[model samples]
Target: MSKFKYIVVALLLSACTSDDTDTLIENSNTLTNYLQDRSVENGAVIACAGNTEDDTVSVEIFFYPEEDATNYRLYETSSTDVDSNDFLNYNRIFLNDAPVFNGYLRKFTGEFTTERWFIVSFEKDNEIKLSNPIRLKNESQPTLFANAISINQQLSQMPLFNWNVNSEMNNAIFFQVLSTINNDLISGTYTYENQFQYYDTSNVILNITNGTPPDLVLGDDYKMTIMDVSVDNWINEIFVSQFTVE
Candidate 1:
């Protein structure tokens, strides 16, 4: 009788131990796979000013899941303060097409100024997975001038270019002049300092007397592009315009 009682007690203890072990395993799995692996990409801040009418901005995101997630949702916010819920707005949401991971693209466009902030968020399984933010600024536009030109009396010297001087340029604007023969390849290159609007009493001009000339072959077409300096050196909202060298 004593042996039987001891055996029964041992069996009960073993069952309790097994139950504890199973509980631990379940809790471990929940902690390990609690959230989805989500990330943000190509986040940028765009600025616009002046008489410009339309512009577009795009952003991309990539999400990875530990297991098969059937549904996902995306959210956007516009505040720098993370603690505040005032910026919450549903911009986009979609379901997963693939099982494990994939990429998502988002785009937003409108007239906005320095007063606004843009934020993007991603949610999976009702949990916030990722967030990204960008800040906007109103930067001054730059002015352009045509410096020097050479003219041939036999050729038509209708060399025209357009530019705007920046009143509030954070740094000097860099310029590149491109020219092509027969419209196949660029024949010449020129670089100049970006001029300030204060220096221009009138419109900025490019002329042959300045040592720059619009001498072209008879009956040949030419094209020119006066592009903005690299975005790395300048702030946002720096406007640039181009003209043809007739």
Candidate 2:
């Protein structure tokens, strides 16, 4: 071949090879997955602030860039930093389809009926991103059995409401007092803390303040719901009954 033709053929081969190299570089898109947000709501609790027993649970998990994950699974365990191998002995469930900012919000259908941590398993980039555990506990059930609606001389005088705290409950628990009419909290509500089940089988008062009104309408029917919540939002058990303020 002529010298000019040989040079032209060599240039074409180099251009082809350069194109192949560019394609290879462009295809190297690997990412590490992480959890940007994780939360649990409306899980089964005996007493929530305004929740009922039959309420279903809502879960949320999100990551940046939005499309990195292809699978989201839920695992139940007593431990932390668990992986796929833990899924073997752990109670597991899959939230099928690609992931989105709003995660799978559904009922608690796992085999665990007592207490367990619900951990999110985000599968992306051929790796897993596990979330901080959202707990679900039923062992220490609190009861509002002692709080009864009273009609007396002083409406401003709140009752030292009675309750039962479970042994499995956290040392610090949240207590909510609601004055309700027709099953709705009327006027305002109050919340208090019960530490370490210290006051189990006893009563306490939610002191009404400016945030919560001290006035109660006389001759009007009202009910008091004493609800206790665990520290991790895992337990809520409410006791409710009707009484008129005379």
Candidate 3:
């Protein structure tokens, strides 16, 4: 009777242990499936110009879980290996306050001025699964002017030159304007403007009003180049299409 009782107790303990192991295995499978189904991609582009800052840009991480993910932790790295087991060294973002969802968006805000690349991974059940890597390139430089050209009509009151501002550029410090006649006549200095577009006819130029410089020499061809100058003097050059003055 005593032997039978001991045997029964051993079997009960064994059964309970087996049940616990099975529960762990099921949880692992659920987490794995969730990670496999999720995806990550590049987020929004944020730009900061000069010394000012804006928080409009956000870095987003998207995810969907199959089951109720408790104590979910996010890890990030710059490395490419998606199978690495150890990611504790990488930066982490906790999802404790995040709402349950078939999909969730994690947004990060701060200075992203310099170019950077990062990889993100999810963690649960002592398992680490990596998402697709994201690349964030910083576009803080002033944009190049486009389609600059010299208007025909040399004897005109003023040399007519036009250009398009770089679409990516914002908050320009000034514009550096350069003019050349017959591709040999170089201007002395640059011009400044807070605006994206500019036109030179008469009042802007001394010769246009006084008639001393004559705006331009009649019948002579001219080429003009315009550049957007930043505080750092990062100049984006735009050369005009050549045209002859009438």
Candidate 4:
């Protein structure tokens, strides 16, 4: 072969190899095989906050670790939900270190004005434990539930949370979250009452929940958030109140 032709062939071969390498790298990072390899289940508690001023959404994940799980990985997808057919498209985002209260918690912030979904998983003894799909949607508008909310901080240690729920929300599930001022989830659960007492279990429904009960710090501020969630995981209304521990 002529010297010029030999050089041209060498350049083409290099280009082909580079393209192949890029494809492999992208495939390796995808969640194509995660769903098939993991045992999917529920129990991850997700709280979403939408900033109307910034047109963004913030999601927080707080859950209890499976026995012997050393770490947890969080996956994200723009899909509305991660059904069996859509699970393979999820992309892992956060890899948490050590399965402690603080370690099992993660916060995700994005410029999302629409809804998104996520899945969290952990591995122990080669067995992967995956959480049921959690959804995050931006709700920038106020609702009736927001207008009818009130908190009684006179009994500071365990503030009484009260809200008015009309007949329309009779079947809706209510969620209460207690978090530190810094946004760390302390305790959260699904409840069925219009009035809930912090750190108390009177109104709790299915204690299959997340976060540790707060060890209130004197003079520190904490937040209590109440959400009315629809069956399909859409947050219909949300109200947040901050109170100082006496």
> What Cα-based lDDT does every candidate model obtain?
0.30, 0.37, 0.34, 0.54
Q: Comparing 1 and 2 by TM-score, which wins?
A: 2
- Which pairs clash in model 2? 47-236, 47-237, 171-196
Off by over 4 Å in 4: 1-26, 30-32, 37-53, 57-71, 81-85, 93-104, 113-116, 139-148, 152-158, 165-172, 179-187, 206-222, 244-246
What is candidate 1's lDDT per residue for 98-208, written digit by digit as tens?
221111112233343322333333343444433223333322232233332222222244343444434434332333233453323232222234431211223333211
Q: Which candidate is the best by TM-score?
A: 4
Instruction: Report the Cα lDDT for candidate 2.
Output: 0.37
- Candidate 2 regions with alpha-carbon error over 4 angstroms: 1-115, 118-134, 139-171, 187-214
Distance from true location, Cα of 172 in model 4, Å: 4.3
Q: Which ten residues in a row have the lowest lDDT in candidate 3?
A: 4-13
Off by over 4 Å in 1: 1-36, 39-76, 80-107, 111-114, 119-133, 138-242
**C-alpha TM-scores of all predictions:** 0.27, 0.38, 0.30, 0.57
lDDT of candidate 4 over 1-246, digit per residue (tens): 121011111101122255545654666544444544344433333322233333335343434464466456777675564452244457777544332234433434444546567666666776565555555555433232353557676776767778766444422567676778766778766676667877778667744345456567878888777766544344556677787776
Q: Where is the poorest 10-residue window by lDDT in model 4?
A: 4-13
TM-score of 4: 0.57
Instruction: Give the lDDT ranking, best first.
Output: 4, 2, 3, 1
